[model samples]
Target: MKKAYKKVDFPTEKIRKFLEPGPIVLVSSRWEGKENIMTMGWHTVLEFSPSLVGCMITAENHSFDMIEKSGECVINIPTVDLIDEIIGIGNSSGADTDKFNKFGLTAEKASIIKAPLIKECFANYECKLVDKQLLSKYNFFIFEVVKAHVATSSKYPKTVHYLGEGIFMVSGRHIAFPEKFKPENL
Candidate 1:
């Protein structure tokens, strides 16, 4: 019952359509009393022990300067229900818009970082900038998660993944095979 695979030439720029990693996250930053939020999908977990995460925020984005200068930000994971807010935040700039007020999202004070957390998000990760060697060349930032807050009501979140060009796929289903893995691996 498996469909046959076919090979065809594809555009290199459009490879993200097939290799989009993880879920979309709302990155909130604060600097000099100014706060902003930007929807990001280019982040990845680089390590576990140090709780390292890497993301690329374009210099043109209003949040880029804030996060870079403040050296801290909160990465909030929103569920499928906030799809509209996610799209709105990504489409609009924080330059002249108060994203929290414009999108009707509540900003809660973070414990360690000045950046506020989006209360409606499923999880919030308080991060501090740890490395920026790649920022100048690739606009990439490396952050260390200093604190984390996650909801316990749901075992897993129904997150959304962007497939480029305004297309999104909601997270679906869960499968576990603990027995198939070694004890140490598990």
Candidate 2:
């Protein structure tokens, strides 16, 4: 019923490069009134009805501890203008410096979470952690979006995508494809 295939081995660095171009999300979490922000590339939408998102953070990161304690976080989607700040924040740990203050990024109170949202970001989503078993076992955190705020502007918003290490990429033109393709018939 099922076919078995031989296992293949690929270099970690090469595979990471191949999986580049993922959205760069600025994740903020607060615990015991102390807030921290970090840049994450491994995040994605999980559901639509209740609006859930999944993000993976290394256990060694300070943000991981905060998020685990607070059970909430804010995901900020930044524009291309914040590329330099993103790289700076990503490279440094919040344990040593206040990332928000260092980057001169402004923050506003979130509607549903204690974490503050980055004011300059185009979109912000307040989320509450709904699953922690995954985080404990695999360092994956799943959150349900509680509320969202978006900038009110007509101008196109550009987002930065992380490639690997120090490399970054910007969002390009938008394109849509048909659900079904009829190459031969068309």
Candidate 3:
């Protein structure tokens, strides 16, 4: 017979912190000619060819509604220099205030999407919603990368990693390790 164990429920906040090293992304969406920016931490690459990305936004979030209606969005990858602005955007609501004006974020037109990209970000990916079934059910939006742009500067300043609550980590020096290690006697 199989043994059964009691299930334990972990706190959502703690679980989020454990999933660290996530990129700090500035997500922009436009609807009815109005555009807004929101900071997102729950996002990841899904595919390479015809690149795809998945982002989770709460149903109540204003940006989520806009993106659903517009069918387009821009994901801007930010460096540590924009940490303050990222936090501000994450804490505020686009429905109540103009986040761009409040956070001093500048927007530029995207090549393949109606949504604009953040000018201060290190890189931007213009995407169109490729899948919405998951989004409607779980508030998770999957997009196909239509176009991508990066700053001319080859050197990226420090990057920020979300660690739940008000905590953040800055990117450090790069290090490489051997792909495999062998035992001396083996």
Candidate 4:
């Protein structure tokens, strides 16, 4: 049975707080000899076949220009254990701070991209900028995941999700219903 709920008028601007509570990732990028890390939650998986991912990085971010010019970046998934580092990285500036050194995060060389992967993260997706059509208008970037690295020890890692303001929610228990889906869909 479904539970009853109260519907209240919500702020239009804060609607994302309820709709887009996806996993927060640390995007690492490099240009020339400089490397930086930025915390991002405004991202989504657009396709499976070619593994396409789209994200929004405001032009004001320090890593924005670096990624735009480098045409590559590594999206690292940090677990709930690294919540402090994640929040700190998001609040700090890469232009003035050496995020890797400041946050005490390890930067491992990526397989196909110059951007280093965050060693502490559970998974890392090395991506190449494939489309820029919506970039100028929305600060959105379309990337193709060229390579992926994941930890095998744990099948599921607890990740954090932003809920606007200073609050965050950590991923909870897992639920599976693969049996109910079609074989091909699995």
Clashing pairs in 4: none
lDDT of each: 0.82, 0.74, 0.74, 0.81
Residue 97 CA displacement from its true place in model 4, Å: 0.5
- lDDT tens digits, residues 1-186, model 3? 111111222222222221234777889989997889988888877765557777899988899889988999987777777777889899899999898788877777777678998877776777889999897788999888777766555444466888897888887876545455465312
Error of 3 at 176 (Å): 3.8
Q: Per-residue lDDT for 1-186 in model 2, tens only?
A: 111112122222222121223678899888887888999999766665567777899999999999988999988777777888888888899899888788888767887679998777776777899988787788999988777765556234577887896777888887545557577522
80-103: candidate 4 lDDT, tens digit per residue: 888889999999998899999988
Alpha carbon RMSD to native, model 3: 13.6
Return the TM-score for each candidate structure: 0.88, 0.81, 0.81, 0.87
lDDT of 1 by residue, 102-137 (tens): 998888888788999888887778889999999999
Give the lDDT of residue 121 in candidate 3.
Answer: 76
Q: How good is model 2 by TM-score?
A: 0.81
Clashing residue pairs in candidate 1 (N, C-alpha, C atoms within 3 angstroms): none
Model 4 residue 26 lDDT score: 96
